[model samples]
Target: MKKIYSLLLLVVSCASFGQTIYTENMGTPTGTTLIPAYSTGTAPATFQNSSPIAYSGTADVRITSVSSGYTAASGGGNVLINAIAEYFQIDGINTSAYTSSGLQLSFGINTPTAVTNLLTVEVSTNGTTWTPVTYTPTGIGWTLATISSGIPSSTTLSIRFTSTTASQFRLDDIKVFNFDPSCTLALGTPTAACDAITFGLDTYTVTIPYTGGTSGAYTFTPSSGTVGGDNPATVPVGNIVVSGVTEGTGFTLHITKGSCTYDANAVAAIDCKPANALPFEDKFPYTVGSALGANQTWANANTGDSILAIAGSLSYTGVTSTGNSVSFVGTGAECQTPFTATTSADSGLYARFLINVTDYGTIADASTTYFATLTDGNPSNHKGRLFIKKSGTQYQLGLDAASTTTNFASTLFNVGDVVCVVLGYDFAGNTLKAWFNPTLATLTDATTPDLTSTPTTAITTLGGFLLRQDSATLTPTITVDELKITTTIAGLLGVSQNSAIAGLKIYPNPVSGGTLFIETAANAEKTITVYDVLGKQVLNTTTADSAVNVSSLHTGVYIVNITEEGKTASRKLVIK
Candidate 1:
């Protein structure tokens, strides 16, 4: 024998965040004609104060039994015999306010027998071609249905309930309410600080606009770093401190309430430190045709192939203050140098270089193209990277570290702009900072860092410093000069002027015959030292005579330091 199932549609008025467009209880006097806003069919049901059964209120509408219009079934269960078609519609329903999830249509039903083909709920705007609504309950003890078929676009919408079986059917407490099962999450601005520095513990606050779900807790996940100070199991919508964040770290807040969920993302802010002295400097004073072989200080001549050439060329022109500068065009052209002070315990180091970007080729969004990098030879230990790429029409500076990239400052760089870039690492804080277009005279700390990375694991030892174009498609022409790496800021800017050596003068500033004449105060023991542009000590001598032979030195710019009676002064010496 085949099993039979009966459905009882039960609807109740319930409070919800969404607005209720329409509702009806059918609590009218007995023997009153059941008149909806609109009606159809030759014969319709009448409103009865007491029906076969009332789920809630005192009255309901009933479909009377029919005799002849029923149809026989093919499969041979209980045939739908004497089926009567009737439609009672409530009009003037504006469904435009409904969200993409649609609204709920509910009503109470009282059926006497287990009839398979008994009733069907439908809706339409023109009242001619109706759409059927599936009977799916969403609330407890209530027969719920959704208008998932989408309500008609007309203002005069109508909902009709059709009964087809001979069994009498009753409906009451019809309601149309919004079914919004989603929430809105808002995480406001979060406070941030440098590593180890205290500022309210870098706490942040968040709030949920609608918390109407079963899940009470929320989870905070960082994109590239870790977060702490709040219980992950039962995090609420309030102040929660964040930690272990590095530069470019983004956070996502996840919340689940009942059957709904919401999420939001935000970034943390950190401050940058100033530049310090470096152990190496390079001015690229080699002539145009000179071979770019490895020098005493540099690890390699120049590596990588140019995009437009078969081999990378370090031969470049357009000298600025110095006699020469290195040019990199196309892709992969680069220069690298090795330094012994690569350990994190070196405290701090600064690397500064002057660059003139003549072109910034077509670039796609989020595509990284590097201009300079400091690495520890090990691919895993990428100390820091400085990059500039196109973001829309403007070029922006970015810093890459700890496996994340972050853009800093609103200042945009364009083609033909000559600027100095200073990259520094602070071992004390384990952070990286950068400055763009800094004043070379004073080497003042960039008021605001172009970019800064959060405290990370200290790079114990560095292998080499590199300047290259990492993008294949980016064919930018850049001239780099005056590259310097020092451990103190004053060393890069200039030594302080000494008043005791004011009367001393160096004659034949641009000496050609390799003979330098120095005029010093009488009866003073003076010590002189000459350093190449690379900060390499080339010549040192102590003399009472004024004339010094420099024939052994090459043609270039050098810094001459003179010390007399505990007073020191520095002068630039140009060899021709």
Candidate 2:
């Protein structure tokens, strides 16, 4: 009875814990396959065919059979060709298999390639008269081909090719080939438990060439020697690898036949566990001035430095010196995994913040907190601006009106309603824009979006500042990385925040007097807390468990505070 009661109590506690921590912020893709590689006859057996030779000619593919008479039976036993679906460009495709062709020979198959190789095809207007569809150059590799001009306007098309002048003809390999895309393989973030894992895969789009009569069986399975993980499901022309892949530090997805295999940053390899659905980011509680331990900052904060921390916490004494910059410190950040911008658009530093948001304390006060501090009036009379601090529910960017200048304004962002937020001041246009996710904020000259909010000249000259999150109230749960601040919008688009898994999240935001669940990683030791609207701590607890509770709290708007080690995270919670 005692054991059973304890177990039931534990379950209840977990349910209650979940009620307090609502996972909202989602992690970005650690890595993606922009361009994958595909090849004919590669190791790990990516394709199959009866007698398809791995297309390997440097130029356009060509095949000549002497006594075949353009007959399928006479050719080298039905030519079966298979190529990795995603990667490769078709160079050139031309069929010349006939010796005074009797009837118009036409056929083709549309697989991952541009089109099948066959003739005797035609296009009909109303199922009556048929017109020959013009042959077009497959975009795979061929650069020059103006054959798509005479294409008929009918879905039903038949083609017929007769050897009028020449009695002999030959066919070559479809032209398609190109370099492979880049890839990275890693877990949410590299920590102790499961950080030393990796996975590699290929990706690309292969254009088919040919029309009709090209029939054969095709299949796409996981590459050979795949130590584990579900195999890729074969599609009409592509293959989708939808499985939780886990590999040790040295695992390799070896490829053959000139196929490009990218080490896509799947997750931190450590967190690559099979789940019912795609894994979401783990949510951490948030607080201020939380201790994130040592090694959060670089040995010597300077240019060309990097740092690595999921929920890192740090504090700056003052924004002093001319060439000062704080960043996530680590070698991987410096070498293997450089930071990229949040999206391909927008302006900011790579994954980390450049701390350019004006108005830290209401625009007039000249005090920098968190990673930067205020300084005396400068030649430009510019007060420094502190960057964003990721809370459990919102991202605080910009300064309070009184902190920097009387014109400073900050932007707060939440999940779903706002996935990404960029607080920027465009100097060229004298504009302050706060873009949320896909929602663009047109500069309307409002007080919040006023261009005079911050000393644009001072902020620009600072070349931006970098700060680590340090929560003072309870424990901060939010995690931020890939912080970048830039003047040019083009530079911001180049940042990739999806590198580190950043896999932290909570669920059921705005809890209504029920269970609050928090799901996070094994290596994370977090502290969870609850607060009222008055900024008073109501509940505080710390454990390695994945859930928390707030059922006892009053029914109203509250804040959940999470502190891991010293890094604090906070999110607003509602009790029903």
Which predicted model would earn the best TM-score? 1
lDDT of 2 by residue, 1-576 (tens): 000000000010101111111110011111211111213323211212112222221111112221122111111111122222211111112122211111121222222233332322233334346465445434332122212233332222222232222112222111111221221111111112222211112111111111111122212232222222222222222222222233222121321212222221212111211111111111212223222111111111211222323222222221111111222311112111111112223332211122222212222222223333221112112233333454444445454213333332354554223134344544444334543332222322232432134343333322212333322231122233323343343434432211122345767776764777765554366667675554345787666777677777878987675545333344567777
Off by over 4 Å in 1: 1-279, 289-294, 301-303, 306-320, 342-344, 362-366, 377-381, 402-404, 439-447, 496-576
Q: Write the per-residue lDDT of candidate 1 for residues 1-576, one digit (tens) a residue.
A: 111112111111123224445555443222233343112212112222222212211122332221111110011111111236654555566666555355666554444446353577777776577887777433322232344445454555677766665555555555566555343332333444445311112222222122222234544444434445544234434444544544222344443344333333323222111111134445554434332322222323223443121111222122125434566665443545555455656666677777777665665654556667777653234578877766566677778664446555567877766677778777767778888776556554444666788645665665567766554465367767766666555556643333336478897989998899887765366677776765556887777788888998899988786656444456789999
Error of 1 at 264 (Å): 61
| lDDT minimum window of 10 residues, candidate 2 | 1-10
TM-scores, one per candidate: 0.38, 0.21
* Predictions in order: lDDT: 0.50, 0.28
Please report the candidate that would top lDDT against the real structure: 1
Mark the regions of model 2 whose C-alpha exceeds 4 Å error after superposition: 1-515, 521-523, 549-552, 563-572
